[model samples]
Target: MTALPDLVLFAKYPVPGYAKTRLVPALGAAGAADLHRRLAERTVGILLQAGAPVEVRFAGAEEAAFRQWLGDGVRLIAQVEGGLTERLIDAARDHPHIFFGADTPDLDVGVVASARAELQNHDIVIGPAEDGGYYLIGMRQARPELLTDMPWSTDAVLRETLRRCDALGLGVALLPTLADCDRPEDLARWPQLEAPGRCA
Candidate 1:
């Protein structure tokens, strides 16, 4: 029997000027950071609701600060030093890990439940994002080829990732498509505040 994948949530420290910088033009440094913090909290709540262990591998702040920000019941760890891709490869070292991002807080518990089950049968499970990236990804082993030298934060992210998976003949399971709050204008696309929406 395969072990349940570890639930690893990736997030930032939400420090002004560093977190959510892309939205700074509209929300200011502080405001964008605040939004970033709130988004993470929302995702935390969703994980709690799903009855899944909350382990956050984060950047920008210490575990103590994250404890205060995210509240209790979450295990926080510092992300390995380096760029996103590097950190991803390191995280992938642990087999059977389901990686979730804080940006997609609107995720419903059902999606998480499904991802867990799919990981048992597939080499990877992807929760596609409207922006062409993925909100969630689960993998059974470290496949550095899928993590390195890829166009991250681009509309081709999902497409390119799938292409690589195909080239490697990896079994992939896809979940529902969702949106991520990346830009100021896209804030309107945020579903009504509800614990019921799919975590995008």
Candidate 2:
């Protein structure tokens, strides 16, 4: 007699010099910003095709710009405040959601399908990225402790999150490893050819 929860996709406004900081040296701020826009659009495109009731959670100062960029079919919510942990905790409190960065172009439909399937049984689901962080994370239930006091934007993030899951006795499912377009070197690892592969 309980209604199933909704899925929310978290992202940020693609502001130049602010988004994708690691790739800026190789891509320049403008180029990196352009890439961010493309990445977000592609992610939303795929999620839209998945045919689920979904909303986009934009985290940053420019909520208006993000809303304009994302446009239609997405209900926009400003992250308001929180580090990654706080924002995610807030999101999970409202929905059984999955959050993914805009950087992973290779997150195919099958992988997303697998995540939704796994969510049926698991408390949390993680899609590990080739870099130290994860591309996607989903939770059927909110466990704020799993996200607190952990390093963000490091290779240790996924490992530490898993550790917290263990500490909290939460069941987690793993999705296939995908490449996150963080550093300049990650461009080669991307499966699609939407643009020229820029390297270090």
Number of clashes recorded per candidate:
6, 1
Any residue pairs clashing in model 2, and if so which? 132-155
lDDT of 2 by residue, 1-200 (tens): 33343557777677789877777887788777777777878788788776666678786656677667777777788775857777877777644777766778887678877888887788899999877679888887677776788888778999998988898888999988988787788755653432534311
Q: What local distance difference test score does each model get? A: 0.82, 0.75
lDDT of 1 at 52: 57
lDDT of 1 by residue, 92-196 (tens): 756688888877645888999999899899999999998899999889887888889989988998999999999999999999998888887776666442222
The global Cα lDDT (0 to 1) of model 1 is 0.82
Worst 10 residues of 1 by lDDT: 191-200
- Each model's TM-score, in the order given? 0.89, 0.86
Best by lDDT: 1
Off by over 4 Å in 2: 1-5, 60-63, 191-200
